[model samples]
Target: MPGRRARRRPVGDALAGTGRFTCGVPEAVGVKRPSLDAVRGFDRAVYVVAVGQLINVFGSGLVYPFATVHFHLQVGIALAVVGLGLGARSVTTAAGTAVGGYLADSVGRKPVMVSSMALSAVALASFAFVPALAAAVPPGVAAAAGVSRVGVAFVGVCVASGFVAGLYTPASSAMTADLTDAEARDRGYALLKFTNNVGFGAGFVAGGVLYSLASVSVFLLDGATSAVVAVVLLLYVPRSDVGGDEEADADVDSSAESGASLARWWAAATQPRVLALAAINLGIAVMYAQMQTTVPIVAKEGLGLTAAQLGTLYVLNPLTIVLLQIPLVDAVAVWRRTRGLALSAAFWAVSMVVAWAADVGVGPVAVGVALVGGHLVFRTVGEILHSPLASSLMSSLGTDAERGTQLSVLEMAKRVGIGLGSFFGGLFFDYGLSTAWWGVLVVVCLGVAAALLLFERSVTPRENGAFGDATES
Candidate 1:
């Protein structure tokens, strides 16, 4: 009654006596709740794409986790060869990203995404069928194909998959940017990340199960999911020009250089503020790379953990993210994005130290577990702080006309971080576990924090406004 308006009626009237309470009319409600408003305001394409992502990622999950293992064991490729194949994939992926970004800007986002999905599906299918085909060849034909043919074909397919992925990444990212405004981009991308991880976790488990059951089934299912995603996009995503024209912004940026070179793909990406943020991102990514290369080796060899025990630790990272990502993003919605990023970097930095200290005693396994769990919690906390805000920040930095090109550059920076991080992490580990886990990682984290501070200072007030101006709701 306090919050609602009531109509007066005669107390003795039968109608009044029989009436059940109806509090407020729709028109009388002055504003919608934030949750409802958020749902109502979302671009239909975002939801559609989210669904497609879930399907596609789950499929990818089945094969990606087992790729190296499959090549080495089932395909009988040497471990070193498999490693070489992976490196080749990364190289193609980087090149593809650059080209994809340019195309997303030149043509459109949806076409590039849909086409890439379809192409990737074909590549995945080849991954499944090529081995069987190679085996079935006549003796003479098989001789012509050579003993290494199966391995070569699989690697080629992997390379193609990488290139296709590159073609799609910029378009997909730019599409999300096109659909969201600066204000809503964080939540939009947050939801996307949440959806993606859910799929990723599911895929990780399911892929393992399928791999054990039948190795090739993983690739078949992965390819099927890709096809399904392509179909879904074709049916549901709108075809309108989503990446808005920002010719004026492009003109402004171009004029500052006095002249534009035909070969200067980096022109839009070289803004001082953009470069600084990209550097900080690269640093954080280097720290992140440790989870894959450094953490597992240390856990097994240094901590005396079993393979199963180590797997459990790996699971904790995404599980924590899937459960807490949204709440964490919402919690920090009131803080400046830059400040939030710095806080996350600190958490990540401290987590490495905690993990290092946990190994001092070789005490109770439970104690080790507790310490590692604490590290995971903090790492995920940092992830929550970084993931959504980072996407939104990158999106906000780009103009409409150059969004795809600029974002591709950002993606390349990330790839560079991963490549270099893995390289340095292995080098450090070779020297000493402490050197890699403590010295290198800690220094990188500090650099990330410092870089972020510099970025905050160098950028205009508007750039830091994501949290300051974000409505509480």
Candidate 2:
């Protein structure tokens, strides 16, 4: 076959905490050579995928903001029930993502993706019944225990969502690779983040509405919408992009001669770069997760932000990405990739330092303004620095056949970090803000160190700008 069809010059970058090449947009649209098309070419495909992700993430965001309120206020769950539900869901989600990554790598992206969404639908649907169960709580039940029952249900949904994540994430990442070359990976992933951000915003607003009216029904509504998304994806998302069914031929290190062991699964998930990717992602998760707890605490108690002002924080982060990530990616593409990574680390360090200072004792207004503004600049800068390079790196490193699996692993690591960080950070923030801020310091500092590891001339920039140095797809 003639060397892959002569392609167009890649579009220079910017995206949601990511960026990518924009070559095919003009040609695909019957336009002539490069004229700085605005998210036109391959960007179109990136946005399409965003639509699906938007739906999925919106559902997630909707549930997150209100689950507690639903269980306690409307359903009358005890405090212990709330804790159990949160903890159980976190663990279950982590487990699901890990297993799901293996499934994506070993089985096929489509199967996992399809399965995950269906499971999420089932799990989310089940949550609708929580109100009914809570209504039956005995008068003398441990308030916390009644809450625990609610927690158990949440845990159940989380476990099922694990299956959803296992199925959806791998396929989703692989699809990023499928639709574009290495050059476009950053933009593709950035688009993914943008979709998520927008979804989250929409969800937050919708959730406030749902919960103020009736919390449990939000789950029911979210579940129904997600089921619709799954069907559409099943109908449209290409299976080959996720992976082919080749696991039957792969070796299975059956352990303890046990029926339910994960020996084979672990073997697959531990593939090279998976752990390194996870470590870096773990740091990101820690930083990212604080939005719900730690970051907001710093925002409110430290900075004196009202709910409306707090909402502005979200606007700054995503809006910047929407406007700047692609251009930033294009610019970084000209410099050393590691330099971008380093810059990203610095941005994180600054953002945290700013927030920490405010939280610890900086004047409330000054800290608040600095924290929000600093966060906007730093996060935007960080996204430009890390998004394209990291994603492209993963694209470069993973085997063509297993690219989706690699993406799944990266996502899995993030979930793991989020779970652990949420609990730890929550306790610190709730029990003591100063101590919690310390934890943030340690994590952000480590993020800087992780960036240094990416140095060393051995690392080469791929045709695509992403995280790992995987072979081009």
Best by TM-score: 1
In model 2, the runs with Cα more than 4 Å from the true position are 1-38, 43-47, 63-90, 125-147, 208-218, 245-268, 297-313, 335-338, 357-361, 364-377, 380-388, 433-443, 454-458, 461-473
Per-candidate TM-score against the hidden true structure: 0.75, 0.74
RMSD of each: 10.3, 7.0
Task: List the candidate 1 regions with Cα displacement exceeding 4 Å.
Answer: 1-40, 68-88, 125-158, 244-266, 294-313, 354-361, 364-375, 426-438, 467-473
| Per-candidate local distance difference test | 0.67, 0.58
What tens digits encode model 2's per-residue C-alpha lDDT throughout 1-473?
A: 01221134633433221322234221121111222442445634345567877887777766664554455445665433443455455556666766665666556666676677777777777788764554455545535454354454555565565555555766667766666655455555665766676776677666656655665666777777678777867777555523545444546655542233245445445765556655676676665554554565566556665444555555566566655665565555534445666667667667666666656666658656766667656756776557556666666665666566566677666666666656666566545555456556556756655644663234444532333233323
Query: Clash totals for all models, in order?
Result: 0, 44
As for model 2, its CA RMSD to the true structure in angstroms is: 7.0
The model with the greatest lDDT is 1
Report lDDT (Cα) of residue 317, candidate 2. Answer: 63
